[model samples]
Target: MDMKQAATFIIALLCAMCASAQTETPDTISSRQLDEVVVNVEKPQVRAEDGVMIVDLPGIVKDKPVDNILEALGYLPGVMNNNGMIWLTGASNVTIILNGELANMPLQNLYQLLYTTPVDRLKNVEVMYSAPAKYHVNGAVINVVLKTPTPLDGLQGQVRAGYNQAHYGSYGGVLAATYAIKDWSFDLNYGLTSNKSWSREETWSNHLYDGKRTIIEDDMRRIGHNWSNTIFASASWKTLKLTYNGQIVSDSKSWNLSSGTLGNYTNAYNMLSPVGYHNIALRYAAPFGMTVGGDYTCYSENRSQSLFKDTDYLLGSENRQDINRWHVYVDQEHQFGKWQLNYGAEYQHSKDHSSQHYGIVGMADNPDFDDILNEDVASFYVGTQRSFDWGLTFNASAKGEYYHNKYQHNWNFIPQLGATYYKTPKSIFQLNFDAQRIYPSYWELHGGTSHINDYSTIIGNPKLQPYIQYDAQFNYILRQKYVATLYFQYGDKAMVQLPYQSPDALNLIYQTINMNYERVAGLNLNAPFGVGYIWNATATANIMNRRAKANHFHDISFDNSKWIFYGSLTNSFKFSQNCPVSVSIDFSYISPSLQGIADLSAIWKIDAGVKWLFGKKRCCELDLKEDDIFNKWSPTMTISHAGQDYRMKVHDMTRNFKLTFIWRFNGFKPKESNSIDTSRFGTGK
Candidate 1:
């Protein structure tokens, strides 16, 4: 039988089993209330389930002056924030999701969302070392689950304001409200922010040819002004849900090359981008723990940039891009005695259009490039979970996808397997194996070029190929307080971006290309501890080795390898048992690391904060934070490849102080609400 026919047959058989396994209702039932009891104990911050690690953000960040989710992530285990980017402890490829579904936005937009959303709206964050087939993702995954509004009738809302001072002043405001009655509910969240910042960068390059060397230096200053707005709304009735999310951003920048001898290269530009997504989902539960659901999602993005240099007629450029995507999916699950089954299918289609215009003084007319791309993807998978009598649980699955582009087509299959053994109530062991494929983004495949200055430029490659990898991990947990993990991965025909210099002149070019192979192996450790009733702390460390081979640059081909280390510690203190104030400090360090041909130097940082709660009901909060208090957060880069020596340093607004105030009001007690997971749609860069 064909795959589709087989899937249909299995689903029908499972439905029959679910019907037959249902038990008859009892004729008589009685209920009684027992005496109330309360237990007081410290709640754990980290938990392990099957093969995934769950971090309770509310329990960990309660005493910290964390306004947003990004600030709270610094205290989580195995997570680091380098500038505005997130880097996992031992993984090269990682994806972030919202409430178990794909975020469907760019990196900058994701950062903005994290900064604007308050931490009180978050419940838990799940970290998966290897993604399952049901998720439709390639590598490691981080899922952020938000707190659903209480289902009780009445109204609740919060108002917040904050300000920060660095190179300049920045301010923001947020408002959120929720209302529920009977079986219907509604929620709204809106935020606005504005900022002004100054930054500086220094670069030095040495070119070698004909047994001689020439040096060049470029130092630049940038001044920027930006404003952004975000809005989200949701409505639910019984088993049906609908959500809408949108963002609008505007940015303007002015820059000058102050110490370069390249004839006063100066530029200014303005950009505007808007993004939106709409999702609808339905879920139903039947007899014998059988559940079914489906989701339809729509996403779109529009961006425009205008550029000018020296004079409007000397050098100018304009670019615009528009994207639209639609996704549909259906899933089913059934639970019987010691066995569970899950299956799903999904389809996605996307259309992207981009255009650019370039103008120079000597050109007769402006040069322009325009292109359109279409892509369609279909996927299906079946997974099963079972618990054996010998204190062992296992899960296994197989999946495949048919991918088609305007000019090419392919089919691929992957397998996933995991097993766990419960040695005792306090100790456990787990092993996991996964395989997946990674594809490049739309702009990367369009072969677009954008100029940086007179002698430097960046370009994309249209001939890039997709790559696949196989990963394996082993983990051990003790008393739910300590953890150790070991992992390894190997990839063939991988890809990486590198900087290249022209052999005859002092020109620099950045481009991406496919490599022969790459391998990574790593280990991670974590522990949480407490001293008496006033002190608590958590520590994490990671060590890894990486190697890349068969990389080519001009006439030279070489291999690169390195060892990297990372560590972090977070401490919290309470002055007394009756006080409503607390203090927290966080410290972290990263040793030298290698990214392809470039070598990065070590970096360290320290942050401290204090929080105070007031009012009869503790409805008001005041937070004071000092970021990079020691002023030791600078990162440096060095490269020595293809007879070129280069180094670059950036000093931006990495240090700052901020104060915030929040007032909350509620007319009814909050109750937990139930929401369906729609995380498999709107996947993007």
Candidate 2:
């Protein structure tokens, strides 16, 4: 083995020895035996083959999912991927699925639907960055496993309704439903809300190189309306499984913008976005017991963005955008003695189209940029999961994908291996090594002028390269409960986002680029206590370094890169009364961000809610969520190329309150089925 492999193996060996005391069983956790959380989750974690934190969705939500969609995947730390869009990392892509089928709709629109759908509808939202044998090439995968039972021999259904309002007199309504027969299942859900929110901003900056300084202040008001809808179904006959998922979402927002240096009046900005999506999957289990599954997705997305500057040129025109993704996959798995073998092939095609009407300037030149995206891809994956007599399970998997996009066509094979060892009845030790390959997204390949707003123009790079990452993780579990994990990752051709100077624009622009290699290593630990008068609580801590494996930009004098620390403390509290109340506090600290180019900042966010129940099956709730409750100093500030000079933009918001209600008519207990509420199972995660 090479040096890297040899070093990893040595480290793994040392960890296995030091943490040997952790190898144990569930009973070890309590005087009475209790099962541990199992994170089967797409064969990703190498820590322990048998158990890991299962991002337990159902356990987190006391009520059925009819309350809110975010509740479906609320247990996962990485569920909220928002860096302006659905980005897994600060600058990576993300794709979501429901019932193993893709949600061919615009992601923004998808979030809208979830806003309408009750969380109780989802069985679970499985989040995994790695592509499993049964998955396609769509970055990370978010499988929204709908609620269901394990017995697999009956029909079940549930419908939930909820209402919520805010201090601003704004309110929302949500409806969620699911029906599953012996061989078929169907689901329908929606969420509608009208909200009033406002923002005030003050900026002070000096374009040192341009010999200019500007002081600006602006306050904006927005009455945002969001409507979301979802439909899904799945059928299984013996071993064959067929599935369908569809979503229709729309959001319209009105904003008032003003600037002291550039403008004096509050300018109104309005945008209406409509998105529709549909997908179908067909899977067949061969007579030999091996299974094959394929799926297709279609999306109809349109965005109309407008700015009201009150002037013809300043009167921002309405702009439109369209995006679509098509994917088909086939995979198989078989049992071989102590090993389970899996393999698969996948094909994908994606296209993005932008329609520009009239905006600031330059966007009128190209209505649709073909270079934005046009590609065909083929991929193959294989793996094996085996268990040892010591109760240790080893899982190894690999993937090779080929992409033929306009910018580049390349092939890469990524490999991963993991081992879980149980040393004693109360302990567990695990280790894993993974090499992942990532290709640039449509925008990364071609980001050009956007007709939407002054949100800087986008530019694409034809010379961009693929990202190859080496990931390692080590974990120690105690009493099948408390857990600690240390992770390290290095990447060559790592995708990084940097502001690119726009010579002809009125705003700053940041583009995704592979100008530098990055290496990051961090640690994560979680402690989940038993339920009590006080809700469960989890504590997490992490530190990561983004090293400059290589750099080329000279204007930016830098070497060695920068490091950042992330930490979070979460809690859940409940009232024993018929009504339940919950509260959460989130804080994120960034040490000057990567490159040490900016000042360090701390962000404190808070969310509080109360669920009032008249009985066991009926309830209503009021939720108050706000970012920067203290209206403290701005949380995030970045300077990028805007028009001819670099402009600084800071985002800070005040408190937002939302009240919600939930009600369920007779919880659907399978008619001939046991009324045993299995929902209460898996209490500890």
Candidate 3:
């Protein structure tokens, strides 16, 4: 047994003999007695139509102990999580889609498969900022909806394990499976994680080359080990579908640097990554009421990095990157009463290859470098949505695109708008607008360079350019649990990562530029309630203002303006109705922001969790968690404009303690999806 474990045990024994021959056929026992003739519906936990906004992840992880989906997206509401990158309040561009297509993978393997998936297999999470044109997305979108088990006639699954202690100590495991037999269904997932981390960093710099002014200081220590693996598989028969998601990562690091302007340094690094994506789909439901689909997607990535220089033995080089991607789509939708029509077409292709190999220990002319890139895109879209009888509703769209790269080629046309109004039945109002385009990634167009010793380095830019964004929003809802938003966004060429100052006098290059404008204006508030009878709550708030300009940097030109605030709160406690136990608490706060040339400071966090349940249909469970609890979650960066001056501080591993266990057997429940799958177009960034 080792032909890949005998081909995964002969494909799980031929899918359990095709689910035991469809339950010994008899029309699957009258279709399992007509699927138990049941009807139960419940939905609501934020909702808004047309311009989208829907969150109902089982009513927000009811009694939370949420495992995965990035800890349930930090409890929703405008979703923001920095340091783990995920932002949405006032959006600066974000995209992630799974059920409604587009999760093409990469972007650190989609955040390691959404932090190892399982949030009860998810179901509902959608937020779109003017993304229409039949979901041929643009600008902002989240959309994650899964859990579509629809009777596999039994055979459920779950098994998990976890343990963690920060400052070093870690463990992990997970295995999942689902099988169904009438109209066919099968799903499988595997996970593995390992970790060891510790970090500390400090830096200060001020340099002005050949005419004096040079001040530098540094202190650093980092020790690391991170291992990851995640895989997902899907198979569907009726309406045809196939899917796979993958992730693999291995990282190792050792660091020790003490510098007062380049003196002592010690570094060791290793990295390996493998990313994947695959999908095939087809759907139809047209006897005239239209609903058609088509999909194909494939993505790949191979990465490698190795660097070493323990003080001065020097010999740090070897970097590689490879990527391949392709995507195709076709879509159609129809509904002719209150009016709804959507259309789409898409195509995408990508290729990138990179290499760097430099050495001194056996140096044969020591320098080697290579980069290759290719990109192509084509898209078309049309959309319409309408409804009226006084309480208005309307949506519109038009999108067209053609882009190719090898330097440049373009064609674009995009337009979108939305409106909704309902003055009674709990009031509502909304409006949205959009025009967006963002491209440039593939290591920012693969013009590469990397090194962080002998004075820092990391540069890439293949004439990087492609940016255009304009967004607007106004939303209000009350009585459905209050929510309000007013937003604005603007961009033109914006793409940043600038920190130049290298003309000998001690280097500091950090490039990736294109910014002459950037903006954000916002307000968002969300409140969800429940008080008498042991808490149960949710709250969010964000207020913002930001501006940026990089005036064609020659050595970093700058202009940045800022005002920002953030807030969050989540609570749940139900002391006891004869004890099954529960508790949860979450808090967040952030203030101080001004990106471009840094200047970021305020940060805060607190998290807590506890849950326990007895066996017998409670399926077995246990959880205890703690994160950043009073650690004050540090994060600091400061950079003082042109002639350059900078500062940095970080202390990692964000406080931790975790213990988890879960087991489930018979009743697995995870199906439920009726249409909508575009197979994630061209994945991550």
Clashes of 1: 1
**The candidate that achieves the highest TM-score relative to the unseen native structure:** 1
- Per-model TM values vs. the true structure: 0.85, 0.74, 0.32
Query: What is the per-residue lDDT of model 1 for residues 530-645, given as tens digits with 9 covering 90 to 100?
Result: 77547778888889898877646544565888898888888887655434576788888889877666788888888887787655456778888888886667777888876868
By TM-score, the better pick of 2 and 3 is 2
Q: What are the per-model C-alpha RMSD values against the true structure?
A: 13.3, 12.8, 23.9
User: Candidate 3 clash total?
Assistant: 12
lDDT of 3 by residue, 1-685 (tens): 6699997984565455445434442346555677668454434577677667777865666578766676677577777766566777766666777777544554555665676667777888877777776666776677888776757447777787889898888898887877778888888878888878787878888777888877888777777676777787778777566666766555543444444556666665555444445444545444554445544445544433334444346555656656566666677778788898878787877666666666545555334567777778888888889978888877888888999978999898889887878857376787888887777666646555666676776766779888888888887877655778899998887888756777665788887788887888889998877664367888888888888877777544677888898888888775433345567888988888878767889889888887765466467778887887877788788887666777888777687889888887776534444122222222111
lDDT of each: 0.68, 0.50, 0.70
lDDT of 2 by residue, 503-560 (tens): 2333434555664666666666656553654456655555666665335431452345
lDDT of 3 at 614: 49
Worst 10 residues of 2 by lDDT: 674-683
